[model samples]
Target: MESVGITIRLFGAFRKFGNGSEIEISVRCGTNLKELRVLLSQYLRENDPKFSETLVVDSAIANDTKILTNDFCIEKSCTLAILPPVCGG
Candidate 1:
């Protein structure tokens, strides 16, 4: 299976992992945002027992330009940001 390299920029609660900013990972060529979320969740659980998969699921995936929907397919190498939910008044 062909794969592509992707960089995930951490935000909010997810910033606590690795270097506290970004993470690089490989995913299948046609992997969509929703599938990527599951892959990320698995990665976190394996890397850190305390990592919360729920956070990953609730996070928004965005590229350098804009936020992508769950069905958006990643076709090439790129940088994506994980924007976790935030609550403020």
Candidate 2:
């Protein structure tokens, strides 16, 4: 591990990424949400190769119940919830 870690939470159809509701991942200090996404993409490409293209498939990133932006540097380790896209009949 390089620095502190963060938990990447998955919901809805995004559960395939972690094979469950949540998964813990490590990231280097100063990593932003966008960079974290890149790390996640790599992780998926390595672990869940099939779900690589479906990561949330269009989702929102949240931290402590608040939405996080690309520039939001993840200085503190915490849980990030990824809410997948909604679908209806």
**Highest lDDT against the true fold, candidate:** 1
Candidate 2 lDDT for residue 76:
72
lDDT of 2 by residue, 5-53 (tens): 7898887776766757788888888888778777777777787667654
lDDT of 2 at 58: 64
The 10 consecutive residues of candidate 1 with the worst lDDT sum are: 10-19
lDDT of 1 at 49: 92
Clashing pairs in 2: none
Compose the digit string of candidate 1's lDDT tens values, residues 1-89: 79999999988888887699999999999999989999999888888998878888788999888989999999999899999997868
Candidate 1 residue spans exceeding 4 A from truth = none
**Which residue pairs show collisions in model 1?**
none
